[model samples]
Target: MKVKSAATQVHREQPLVLGYKVDIARQESVKAMYDSLVEVFNARLDSLINNTAQMEPYKPFLESDPDTYWRTWEVNIQGLFNMARTFFPMLSEQSLQVVYGEQGLWASCVNPGAIKIKITAGALEAVRNVLPDRLAIAGDTIAWLASDRKEWLGGRYISCPWDMEELVAKKDEIAKEDALKLRLVV
Candidate 1:
Protein backbone atom coordinates (compact mmCIF):
# COMPACT_ATOMS: atom_id res chain seq x y z
CA MET A 1 0.00 0.00 0.00
CA LYS A 2 2.80 2.40 0.80
CA VAL A 3 4.56 1.55 -2.45
CA LYS A 4 1.39 2.16 -4.44
CA SER A 5 0.80 5.45 -2.68
CA ALA A 6 4.34 6.57 -3.40
CA ALA A 7 3.99 5.53 -7.01
CA THR A 8 0.80 7.52 -7.29
CA GLN A 9 2.47 10.61 -5.88
CA VAL A 10 5.41 10.24 -8.27
CA HIS A 11 3.10 9.78 -11.23
CA ARG A 12 1.22 12.90 -10.25
CA GLU A 13 4.44 14.88 -10.15
CA GLN A 14 5.91 13.22 -13.26
CA PRO A 15 3.30 11.80 -15.55
CA LEU A 16 5.90 10.31 -17.86
CA VAL A 17 6.92 7.91 -15.09
CA LEU A 18 5.29 4.51 -14.76
CA GLY A 19 5.53 2.27 -11.78
CA TYR A 20 4.75 -1.38 -11.13
CA LYS A 21 5.33 -3.55 -8.14
CA VAL A 22 7.08 -6.84 -8.85
CA ASP A 23 9.18 -9.43 -7.07
CA ILE A 24 12.34 -8.92 -9.10
CA ALA A 25 13.85 -12.14 -7.74
CA ARG A 26 11.23 -14.09 -9.62
CA GLN A 27 11.76 -14.50 -13.36
CA GLU A 28 8.02 -14.68 -14.00
CA SER A 29 7.40 -11.39 -12.26
CA VAL A 30 10.20 -9.76 -14.22
CA LYS A 31 8.75 -11.10 -17.45
CA ALA A 32 5.37 -9.72 -16.53
CA MET A 33 6.96 -6.34 -15.87
CA TYR A 34 8.65 -6.49 -19.23
CA ASP A 35 5.37 -7.29 -20.90
CA SER A 36 3.66 -4.38 -19.26
CA LEU A 37 6.47 -2.01 -20.18
CA VAL A 38 6.45 -3.25 -23.75
CA GLU A 39 2.72 -2.72 -23.96
CA VAL A 40 2.95 0.84 -22.67
CA PHE A 41 6.13 1.95 -24.47
CA ASN A 42 5.72 -0.05 -27.67
CA ALA A 43 8.71 -2.22 -26.82
CA ARG A 44 11.39 0.47 -26.80
CA LEU A 45 12.83 1.85 -23.59
CA ASP A 46 15.35 4.68 -23.43
CA SER A 47 17.02 3.67 -20.20
CA LEU A 48 16.84 0.98 -17.55
CA ILE A 49 18.26 1.60 -14.09
CA ASN A 50 18.55 -1.40 -11.77
CA ASN A 51 18.76 0.24 -8.37
CA THR A 52 17.25 -2.53 -6.28
CA ALA A 53 19.69 -3.53 -3.57
CA GLN A 54 19.64 -5.22 -0.20
CA MET A 55 22.24 -4.38 2.41
CA GLU A 56 22.30 -6.28 5.65
CA PRO A 57 23.67 -4.55 8.72
CA TYR A 58 27.43 -4.96 9.06
CA LYS A 59 28.29 -8.34 10.57
CA PRO A 60 30.93 -11.02 10.32
CA PHE A 61 30.19 -13.68 7.68
CA LEU A 62 30.23 -16.45 10.30
CA GLU A 63 27.88 -14.48 12.52
CA SER A 64 25.39 -13.47 9.80
CA ASP A 65 22.26 -15.53 9.25
CA PRO A 66 22.56 -17.71 6.18
CA ASP A 67 19.10 -16.85 4.85
CA THR A 68 19.63 -13.10 5.18
CA TYR A 69 23.04 -13.17 3.56
CA TRP A 70 21.80 -15.14 0.56
CA ARG A 71 18.68 -13.02 0.30
CA THR A 72 20.97 -10.16 -0.62
CA TRP A 73 22.46 -12.25 -3.40
CA GLU A 74 19.00 -13.18 -4.70
CA VAL A 75 17.85 -9.59 -4.75
CA ASN A 76 21.08 -8.11 -6.06
CA ILE A 77 22.49 -10.65 -8.49
CA GLN A 78 19.55 -12.79 -9.56
CA GLY A 79 17.29 -9.79 -9.83
CA LEU A 80 19.78 -8.01 -12.06
CA PHE A 81 20.16 -11.03 -14.30
CA ASN A 82 16.39 -11.44 -14.67
CA MET A 83 15.86 -7.76 -15.45
CA ALA A 84 18.68 -7.54 -17.99
CA ARG A 85 17.75 -10.73 -19.77
CA THR A 86 14.09 -9.75 -20.03
CA PHE A 87 14.60 -6.11 -20.99
CA PHE A 88 17.60 -6.29 -23.32
CA PRO A 89 15.57 -6.48 -26.49
CA MET A 90 13.42 -3.52 -25.50
CA LEU A 91 16.30 -1.13 -24.87
CA SER A 92 16.78 1.56 -27.49
CA GLU A 93 19.90 1.21 -29.59
CA GLN A 94 19.94 4.72 -30.99
CA SER A 95 19.94 6.58 -27.69
CA LEU A 96 22.58 4.58 -25.76
CA GLN A 97 25.90 3.20 -27.01
CA VAL A 98 26.72 -0.45 -27.67
CA VAL A 99 27.36 -2.66 -24.64
CA TYR A 100 27.95 -6.34 -23.86
CA GLY A 101 29.81 -6.50 -27.19
CA GLU A 102 26.57 -5.93 -29.03
CA GLN A 103 26.55 -3.47 -31.92
CA GLY A 104 23.15 -1.88 -31.36
CA LEU A 105 22.64 -1.86 -27.61
CA TRP A 106 24.43 -0.14 -24.76
CA ALA A 107 24.79 -0.91 -21.08
CA SER A 108 26.94 0.52 -18.32
CA CYS A 109 27.14 0.05 -14.59
CA VAL A 110 26.92 3.04 -12.22
CA ASN A 111 27.89 3.34 -8.60
CA PRO A 112 25.86 6.12 -7.08
CA GLY A 113 27.81 7.26 -4.04
CA ALA A 114 26.16 7.16 -0.66
CA ILE A 115 24.02 10.26 -0.25
CA LYS A 116 22.67 11.86 2.89
CA ILE A 117 19.70 10.00 4.30
CA LYS A 118 18.01 9.91 7.62
CA ILE A 119 19.55 7.07 9.58
CA THR A 120 17.76 6.07 12.72
CA ALA A 121 19.75 4.55 15.56
CA GLY A 122 20.68 1.11 14.24
CA ALA A 123 23.62 -0.98 13.14
CA LEU A 124 24.43 1.46 10.32
CA GLU A 125 24.16 4.51 12.59
CA ALA A 126 27.74 4.24 13.77
CA VAL A 127 29.00 3.83 10.22
CA ARG A 128 27.82 7.30 9.19
CA ASN A 129 27.79 9.85 11.93
CA VAL A 130 27.27 12.55 9.35
CA LEU A 131 26.51 11.89 5.70
CA PRO A 132 28.36 14.44 3.58
CA ASP A 133 27.08 13.87 0.05
CA ARG A 134 23.95 15.50 -1.28
CA LEU A 135 21.32 13.60 -3.25
CA ALA A 136 21.89 15.80 -6.31
CA ILE A 137 25.41 14.51 -6.73
CA ALA A 138 24.23 11.08 -7.79
CA GLY A 139 21.02 12.21 -9.46
CA ASP A 140 22.71 14.74 -11.70
CA THR A 141 25.51 12.35 -12.59
CA ILE A 142 23.03 9.65 -13.63
CA ALA A 143 21.03 12.16 -15.65
CA TRP A 144 24.18 13.22 -17.45
CA LEU A 145 25.12 9.61 -18.15
CA ALA A 146 21.71 8.92 -19.70
CA SER A 147 22.16 11.85 -22.05
CA ASP A 148 23.22 11.52 -25.67
CA ARG A 149 26.90 12.34 -25.17
CA LYS A 150 27.74 9.44 -22.85
CA GLU A 151 27.88 6.72 -25.48
CA TRP A 152 31.61 6.32 -25.12
CA LEU A 153 31.18 5.22 -21.48
CA GLY A 154 29.21 2.09 -22.32
CA GLY A 155 30.48 -1.10 -20.62
CA ARG A 156 32.47 0.97 -18.11
CA TYR A 157 31.91 1.42 -14.39
CA ILE A 158 31.04 5.03 -13.55
CA SER A 159 31.32 6.45 -10.08
CA CYS A 160 28.85 9.26 -9.51
CA PRO A 161 31.18 11.21 -7.21
CA TRP A 162 33.78 11.73 -9.95
CA ASP A 163 33.86 15.06 -11.76
CA MET A 164 32.21 14.43 -15.12
CA GLU A 165 34.29 16.99 -16.95
CA GLU A 166 37.57 15.62 -15.61
CA LEU A 167 36.44 12.09 -16.32
CA VAL A 168 35.61 13.11 -19.85
CA ALA A 169 39.09 14.59 -20.11
CA LYS A 170 40.60 11.21 -19.31
CA LYS A 171 38.32 9.16 -21.51
CA ASP A 172 41.06 8.37 -23.96
CA GLU A 173 43.38 7.13 -21.23
CA ILE A 174 40.60 5.15 -19.56
CA ALA A 175 39.63 3.43 -22.81
CA LYS A 176 43.25 2.71 -23.70
CA GLU A 177 43.91 0.99 -20.38
CA ASP A 178 40.40 -0.54 -20.02
CA ALA A 179 40.14 0.95 -16.58
CA LEU A 180 37.13 0.91 -14.21
CA LYS A 181 36.58 -2.78 -14.69
CA LEU A 182 36.81 -5.50 -12.11
CA ARG A 183 40.29 -7.01 -12.48
CA LEU A 184 41.92 -9.73 -10.42
CA VAL A 185 45.46 -8.80 -9.47
CA VAL A 186 47.87 -11.71 -9.27
Candidate 2:
Protein backbone atom coordinates (compact mmCIF):
# COMPACT_ATOMS: atom_id res chain seq x y z
CA MET A 1 0.00 0.00 0.00
CA LYS A 2 1.35 3.43 -1.02
CA VAL A 3 0.86 6.37 1.35
CA LYS A 4 -0.06 9.58 -0.46
CA SER A 5 1.00 12.73 1.36
CA ALA A 6 -1.75 15.29 2.10
CA ALA A 7 -0.16 17.94 -0.09
CA THR A 8 0.22 15.60 -3.07
CA GLN A 9 -3.33 14.23 -2.67
CA VAL A 10 -4.80 17.74 -2.42
CA HIS A 11 -2.81 18.88 -5.45
CA ARG A 12 -3.91 15.90 -7.51
CA GLU A 13 -7.57 16.46 -6.58
CA GLN A 14 -7.50 20.13 -7.47
CA PRO A 15 -9.07 21.05 -10.79
CA LEU A 16 -6.85 22.18 -13.68
CA VAL A 17 -7.10 25.74 -14.95
CA LEU A 18 -9.02 26.31 -18.19
CA GLY A 19 -9.61 29.47 -20.19
CA TYR A 20 -9.37 31.53 -17.01
CA LYS A 21 -10.83 34.98 -16.94
CA VAL A 22 -10.53 36.04 -13.30
CA ASP A 23 -13.14 38.68 -12.58
CA ILE A 24 -11.58 41.36 -10.42
CA ALA A 25 -14.79 43.31 -9.99
CA ARG A 26 -14.59 43.39 -6.19
CA GLN A 27 -10.94 44.47 -6.23
CA GLU A 28 -11.80 47.18 -8.76
CA SER A 29 -14.64 48.36 -6.53
CA VAL A 30 -12.29 48.60 -3.53
CA LYS A 31 -9.68 50.43 -5.61
CA ALA A 32 -12.31 52.86 -6.86
CA MET A 33 -13.33 53.65 -3.28
CA TYR A 34 -9.68 54.21 -2.29
CA ASP A 35 -9.11 56.46 -5.31
CA SER A 36 -12.23 58.51 -4.61
CA LEU A 37 -11.23 58.99 -0.98
CA VAL A 38 -7.76 60.10 -2.03
CA GLU A 39 -9.21 62.53 -4.59
CA VAL A 40 -11.79 63.98 -2.20
CA PHE A 41 -9.33 64.31 0.66
CA ASN A 42 -6.72 65.93 -1.58
CA ALA A 43 -9.26 68.39 -2.98
CA ARG A 44 -10.51 69.22 0.50
CA LEU A 45 -6.99 69.81 1.79
CA ASP A 46 -6.04 71.84 -1.30
CA SER A 47 -9.04 74.12 -0.90
CA LEU A 48 -7.78 75.01 2.57
CA ILE A 49 -4.50 75.85 0.76
CA ASN A 50 -2.15 77.32 3.35
CA ASN A 51 -3.92 76.23 6.52
CA THR A 52 -1.12 74.26 8.20
CA ALA A 53 -3.07 74.29 11.45
CA GLN A 54 -5.82 72.24 9.82
CA MET A 55 -3.51 69.42 8.83
CA GLU A 56 -1.14 69.45 11.79
CA PRO A 57 -2.82 66.90 14.05
CA TYR A 58 -3.99 64.63 11.24
CA LYS A 59 -0.50 64.49 9.78
CA PRO A 60 1.08 62.40 12.52
CA PHE A 61 -1.96 60.11 12.82
CA LEU A 62 -2.26 59.64 9.08
CA GLU A 63 1.22 58.22 9.00
CA SER A 64 0.68 55.99 12.04
CA ASP A 65 -2.98 54.90 11.85
CA PRO A 66 -4.18 54.82 8.28
CA ASP A 67 -5.70 51.34 8.49
CA THR A 68 -7.83 52.15 11.53
CA TYR A 69 -9.13 55.35 9.99
CA TRP A 70 -9.81 53.57 6.71
CA ARG A 71 -11.90 50.93 8.48
CA THR A 72 -13.80 53.52 10.51
CA TRP A 73 -14.49 55.74 7.52
CA GLU A 74 -15.33 52.74 5.37
CA VAL A 75 -18.11 51.69 7.71
CA ASN A 76 -19.40 55.14 8.65
CA ILE A 77 -19.43 57.23 5.44
CA GLN A 78 -17.01 56.02 2.81
CA GLY A 79 -18.88 52.74 2.34
CA LEU A 80 -22.13 54.56 1.79
CA PHE A 81 -20.50 57.01 -0.60
CA ASN A 82 -18.78 54.24 -2.52
CA MET A 83 -21.95 52.15 -2.84
CA ALA A 84 -24.04 55.10 -3.98
CA ARG A 85 -21.39 56.37 -6.38
CA THR A 86 -20.91 52.99 -7.99
CA PHE A 87 -24.42 51.57 -7.97
CA PHE A 88 -26.38 54.77 -8.57
CA PRO A 89 -24.78 55.27 -11.99
CA MET A 90 -25.40 51.68 -12.96
CA LEU A 91 -28.93 51.82 -11.58
CA SER A 92 -29.58 55.03 -13.43
CA GLU A 93 -28.24 53.51 -16.62
CA GLN A 94 -30.38 50.43 -16.08
CA SER A 95 -33.39 52.56 -14.98
CA LEU A 96 -33.82 50.95 -11.56
CA GLN A 97 -34.03 53.57 -8.87
CA VAL A 98 -35.65 52.38 -5.67
CA VAL A 99 -36.55 54.96 -3.08
CA TYR A 100 -36.97 54.07 0.57
CA GLY A 101 -38.34 56.10 3.49
CA GLU A 102 -37.56 56.00 7.16
CA GLN A 103 -40.23 54.76 9.52
CA GLY A 104 -39.05 57.36 12.01
CA LEU A 105 -40.90 59.97 9.94
CA TRP A 106 -44.25 58.36 10.72
CA ALA A 107 -43.26 57.62 14.31
CA SER A 108 -42.25 61.21 14.87
CA CYS A 109 -45.51 62.47 13.41
CA VAL A 110 -47.55 60.17 15.68
CA ASN A 111 -45.61 60.51 18.91
CA PRO A 112 -44.57 63.70 20.75
CA GLY A 113 -46.91 65.63 18.44
CA ALA A 114 -45.47 69.08 17.59
CA ILE A 115 -42.11 68.48 19.22
CA LYS A 116 -41.06 66.03 16.53
CA ILE A 117 -42.97 67.64 13.66
CA LYS A 118 -40.05 69.74 12.42
CA ILE A 119 -37.64 66.82 12.53
CA THR A 120 -40.08 64.62 10.67
CA ALA A 121 -40.65 67.33 8.07
CA GLY A 122 -36.92 67.73 7.54
CA ALA A 123 -36.56 63.98 7.16
CA LEU A 124 -39.37 63.94 4.61
CA GLU A 125 -37.72 66.74 2.63
CA ALA A 126 -34.42 64.88 2.64
CA VAL A 127 -36.16 61.76 1.39
CA ARG A 128 -37.81 63.73 -1.40
CA ASN A 129 -34.52 65.19 -2.55
CA VAL A 130 -32.93 61.73 -2.54
CA LEU A 131 -35.53 60.54 -5.03
CA PRO A 132 -36.06 63.67 -7.03
CA ASP A 133 -38.55 63.72 -9.91
CA ARG A 134 -35.90 64.78 -12.40
CA LEU A 135 -33.84 61.65 -11.70
CA ALA A 136 -36.98 59.56 -12.05
CA ILE A 137 -37.61 61.08 -15.49
CA ALA A 138 -34.15 60.10 -16.68
CA GLY A 139 -34.65 56.68 -15.13
CA ASP A 140 -37.65 56.14 -17.37
CA THR A 141 -35.48 56.44 -20.46
CA ILE A 142 -32.98 53.91 -19.11
CA ALA A 143 -35.77 51.61 -18.02
CA TRP A 144 -37.13 51.57 -21.57
CA LEU A 145 -33.79 50.52 -22.98
CA ALA A 146 -33.00 47.91 -20.32
CA SER A 147 -36.57 46.62 -19.96
CA ASP A 148 -36.24 47.18 -16.21
CA ARG A 149 -38.91 48.17 -13.71
CA LYS A 150 -39.01 51.62 -12.12
CA GLU A 151 -40.12 51.41 -8.50
CA TRP A 152 -39.66 52.74 -5.02
CA LEU A 153 -37.41 50.66 -2.72
CA GLY A 154 -39.37 51.91 0.26
CA GLY A 155 -37.96 51.24 3.77
CA ARG A 156 -37.40 52.94 7.08
CA TYR A 157 -34.52 55.34 6.64
CA ILE A 158 -34.44 56.21 10.33
CA SER A 159 -33.80 53.49 12.82
CA CYS A 160 -33.81 54.43 16.52
CA PRO A 161 -34.24 58.04 17.61
CA TRP A 162 -32.53 57.49 20.96
CA ASP A 163 -29.05 57.52 19.44
CA MET A 164 -29.80 60.73 17.56
CA GLU A 165 -31.33 62.32 20.63
CA GLU A 166 -28.20 61.44 22.60
CA LEU A 167 -26.00 62.90 19.87
CA VAL A 168 -28.07 66.08 19.89
CA ALA A 169 -27.81 66.35 23.64
CA LYS A 170 -24.06 65.98 23.47
CA LYS A 171 -23.56 68.06 20.35
CA ASP A 172 -21.95 70.85 22.31
CA GLU A 173 -19.47 68.46 23.88
CA ILE A 174 -18.56 66.84 20.59
CA ALA A 175 -15.15 67.64 19.11
CA LYS A 176 -14.82 70.29 16.40
CA GLU A 177 -14.38 69.35 12.74
CA ASP A 178 -10.60 69.62 12.90
CA ALA A 179 -10.45 67.51 16.04
CA LEU A 180 -12.75 64.99 14.38
CA LYS A 181 -10.48 64.86 11.36
CA LEU A 182 -7.52 64.17 13.62
CA ARG A 183 -9.40 61.54 15.59
CA LEU A 184 -10.59 59.88 12.39
CA VAL A 185 -7.07 59.66 11.08
CA VAL A 186 -5.84 58.22 14.34
Candidate 3:
Protein backbone atom coordinates (compact mmCIF):
# COMPACT_ATOMS: atom_id res chain seq x y z
CA MET A 1 0.00 0.00 0.00
CA LYS A 2 2.95 2.34 0.44
CA VAL A 3 3.65 2.44 -3.29
CA LYS A 4 -0.03 2.81 -4.06
CA SER A 5 -0.30 5.54 -1.49
CA ALA A 6 2.71 7.26 -2.97
CA ALA A 7 1.13 7.06 -6.40
CA THR A 8 -2.09 8.52 -5.06
CA GLN A 9 -0.18 11.31 -3.35
CA VAL A 10 1.68 12.18 -6.54
CA HIS A 11 -1.59 12.17 -8.44
CA ARG A 12 -3.19 14.48 -5.90
CA GLU A 13 -0.04 16.63 -5.74
CA GLN A 14 -0.47 16.49 -2.02
CA PRO A 15 2.95 15.18 -0.95
CA LEU A 16 5.65 15.96 -3.46
CA VAL A 17 7.78 12.90 -4.26
CA LEU A 18 10.76 12.99 -6.58
CA GLY A 19 11.81 9.36 -6.74
CA TYR A 20 10.79 5.99 -8.08
CA LYS A 21 8.53 3.74 -5.98
CA VAL A 22 9.30 0.20 -4.86
CA ASP A 23 7.98 -2.18 -2.22
CA ILE A 24 10.71 -3.15 0.18
CA ALA A 25 8.91 -6.30 1.27
CA ARG A 26 9.68 -7.85 -2.10
CA GLN A 27 13.43 -8.46 -2.15
CA GLU A 28 13.71 -8.75 -5.94
CA SER A 29 11.54 -5.73 -6.57
CA VAL A 30 13.45 -3.60 -4.08
CA LYS A 31 16.81 -4.91 -5.29
CA ALA A 32 15.88 -4.08 -8.87
CA MET A 33 14.53 -0.73 -7.85
CA TYR A 34 17.61 0.22 -5.85
CA ASP A 35 19.85 -1.25 -8.52
CA SER A 36 18.22 1.00 -11.05
CA LEU A 37 18.45 3.86 -8.64
CA VAL A 38 22.16 3.25 -8.26
CA GLU A 39 22.70 3.02 -12.02
CA VAL A 40 20.48 5.89 -13.05
CA PHE A 41 19.99 8.21 -10.12
CA ASN A 42 22.71 7.34 -7.65
CA ALA A 43 23.81 10.92 -7.38
CA ARG A 44 20.32 12.13 -6.50
CA LEU A 45 19.86 9.96 -3.45
CA ASP A 46 20.55 12.38 -0.66
CA SER A 47 18.40 10.56 1.87
CA LEU A 48 16.86 7.13 2.39
CA ILE A 49 14.16 6.61 4.95
CA ASN A 50 12.98 3.15 6.05
CA ASN A 51 9.42 3.34 7.27
CA THR A 52 8.71 -0.25 6.31
CA ALA A 53 6.57 -2.22 8.75
CA GLN A 54 3.79 -4.82 8.86
CA MET A 55 1.80 -4.98 12.05
CA GLU A 56 -0.93 -7.12 10.56
CA PRO A 57 -2.64 -10.11 12.11
CA TYR A 58 -3.21 -7.65 14.90
CA LYS A 59 -5.35 -10.14 16.71
CA PRO A 60 -4.88 -11.78 20.09
CA PHE A 61 -2.16 -14.44 20.37
CA LEU A 62 -4.68 -17.25 20.19
CA GLU A 63 -6.37 -15.81 17.14
CA SER A 64 -3.20 -14.48 15.51
CA ASP A 65 -2.11 -16.24 12.34
CA PRO A 66 1.43 -17.53 12.06
CA ASP A 67 1.57 -16.36 8.44
CA THR A 68 0.81 -12.85 9.53
CA TYR A 69 3.59 -12.96 12.07
CA TRP A 70 6.03 -14.24 9.48
CA ARG A 71 5.04 -11.62 6.95
CA THR A 72 5.24 -8.96 9.60
CA TRP A 73 8.73 -10.04 10.55
CA GLU A 74 9.72 -10.25 6.92
CA VAL A 75 8.69 -6.69 6.20
CA ASN A 76 9.25 -5.02 9.51
CA ILE A 77 12.50 -6.64 10.60
CA GLN A 78 14.17 -8.48 7.73
CA GLY A 79 13.15 -6.14 4.96
CA LEU A 80 14.24 -3.11 6.90
CA PHE A 81 17.57 -4.74 7.63
CA ASN A 82 18.05 -5.64 3.99
CA MET A 83 17.22 -2.16 2.74
CA ALA A 84 19.60 -0.56 5.15
CA ARG A 85 22.36 -3.00 4.26
CA THR A 86 21.77 -2.61 0.51
CA PHE A 87 21.66 1.16 0.62
CA PHE A 88 24.44 1.77 3.12
CA PRO A 89 27.09 1.84 0.42
CA MET A 90 25.10 4.24 -1.73
CA LEU A 91 24.82 6.91 0.93
CA SER A 92 26.88 10.11 0.85
CA GLU A 93 27.98 11.89 3.95
CA GLN A 94 27.27 15.41 2.67
CA SER A 95 23.55 14.90 3.41
CA LEU A 96 21.71 11.67 4.00
CA GLN A 97 18.39 11.03 5.75
CA VAL A 98 17.84 7.91 7.79
CA VAL A 99 14.59 7.57 9.70
CA TYR A 100 13.21 4.55 11.54
CA GLY A 101 9.57 4.85 12.57
CA GLU A 102 9.09 3.00 15.87
CA GLN A 103 5.41 2.03 15.35
CA GLY A 104 4.83 3.72 18.69
CA LEU A 105 1.77 5.47 17.29
CA TRP A 106 -0.24 2.42 16.31
CA ALA A 107 1.02 0.67 19.43
CA SER A 108 -0.48 3.48 21.47
CA CYS A 109 -3.74 3.43 19.55
CA VAL A 110 -4.65 -0.07 20.77
CA ASN A 111 -4.67 1.19 24.33
CA PRO A 112 -7.75 2.63 25.99
CA GLY A 113 -8.04 6.42 26.51
CA ALA A 114 -5.40 7.20 23.96
CA ILE A 115 -8.07 7.98 21.39
CA LYS A 116 -11.82 8.37 21.44
CA ILE A 117 -12.20 4.81 20.13
CA LYS A 118 -9.79 1.95 20.70
CA ILE A 119 -9.53 -1.80 20.53
CA THR A 120 -10.91 -3.22 23.76
CA ALA A 121 -10.50 -6.96 23.37
CA GLY A 122 -8.35 -9.79 22.04
CA ALA A 123 -4.72 -9.76 20.90
CA LEU A 124 -4.92 -6.09 19.96
CA GLU A 125 -6.45 -5.30 23.31
CA ALA A 126 -3.38 -6.48 25.17
CA VAL A 127 -1.37 -4.30 22.80
CA ARG A 128 -3.01 -1.24 24.23
CA ASN A 129 -0.70 1.76 24.62
CA VAL A 130 -0.80 5.27 26.01
CA LEU A 131 -1.59 6.65 22.54
CA PRO A 132 0.17 6.59 19.29
CA ASP A 133 1.66 9.62 17.67
CA ARG A 134 -0.60 11.68 15.43
CA LEU A 135 -0.32 11.28 11.66
CA ALA A 136 0.42 14.97 11.20
CA ILE A 137 2.95 14.83 13.99
CA ALA A 138 4.82 12.05 12.27
CA GLY A 139 4.50 13.61 8.82
CA ASP A 140 5.45 17.08 9.93
CA THR A 141 8.23 15.80 12.13
CA ILE A 142 9.67 13.85 9.22
CA ALA A 143 9.53 16.90 6.99
CA TRP A 144 11.26 19.01 9.56
CA LEU A 145 13.76 16.30 10.25
CA ALA A 146 14.68 16.04 6.57
CA SER A 147 15.61 19.66 6.44
CA ASP A 148 19.17 20.87 6.99
CA ARG A 149 18.16 22.12 10.40
CA LYS A 150 18.00 18.61 11.75
CA GLU A 151 20.87 17.08 9.82
CA TRP A 152 22.69 16.31 13.02
CA LEU A 153 20.04 13.66 13.66
CA GLY A 154 21.31 11.57 10.79
CA GLY A 155 21.20 8.11 12.35
CA ARG A 156 18.53 7.93 14.98
CA TYR A 157 15.04 6.69 15.69
CA ILE A 158 12.66 9.63 15.40
CA SER A 159 9.42 9.30 17.28
CA CYS A 160 6.71 11.39 15.60
CA PRO A 161 5.29 13.26 18.57
CA TRP A 162 8.53 14.37 20.22
CA ASP A 163 8.76 18.12 20.09
CA MET A 164 11.40 19.18 17.57
CA GLU A 165 12.34 22.30 19.45
CA GLU A 166 12.58 20.34 22.63
CA LEU A 167 14.76 17.82 20.89
CA VAL A 168 16.87 20.51 19.34
CA ALA A 169 17.43 21.94 22.76
CA LYS A 170 18.52 18.51 23.88
CA LYS A 171 20.62 17.90 20.79
CA ASP A 172 23.80 17.84 22.75
CA GLU A 173 22.39 15.22 25.05
CA ILE A 174 20.97 13.33 22.13
CA ALA A 175 24.14 13.25 20.08
CA LYS A 176 26.29 12.60 23.08
CA GLU A 177 23.92 10.33 24.93
CA ASP A 178 21.98 8.80 22.06
CA ALA A 179 18.85 9.89 23.86
CA LEU A 180 16.10 9.25 21.35
CA LYS A 181 17.76 6.54 19.32
CA LEU A 182 16.11 3.11 19.46
CA ARG A 183 17.57 0.57 21.84
CA LEU A 184 16.63 -2.72 23.49
CA VAL A 185 16.83 -1.41 27.02
CA VAL A 186 13.67 -0.65 28.95
Best by lDDT: 1
Q: Could you estimate the TM-score for every candidate?
A: 0.80, 0.23, 0.63
Give the alpha carbon lDDT tens digit for every residue of 14-74 in model 2: 4322222212223465445545644554422111001000111133543656665555455
Backbone clashes in candidate 2 total 3
- Ranking by TM-score, best first? 1, 3, 2
Model 3, 11-86: lDDT tens digits are 8544444465766777777788777776676445655567545556455679879887787788877787778767
Per-residue lDDT of 141 in model 1: 87
| Residue-pair clashes, model 1 | 0
- Pairs of colliding residues, candidate 1: none
Model 1, position 4, has a per-residue lDDT of 60
Q: What is the lDDT of residue 131 in candidate 1?
A: 58
Q: List, residue by residue over 19-78, the lDDT tens digit for candidate 1.
A: 799888899999998998888878778777787777766677688888987887899899
> Once superposed on the true structure, which residue ranges of model 2 sit more than 4 Å away at CA?
1-27, 30-70, 97-186
Where does candidate 1 have its weakest 10-residue lDDT segment? 114-123
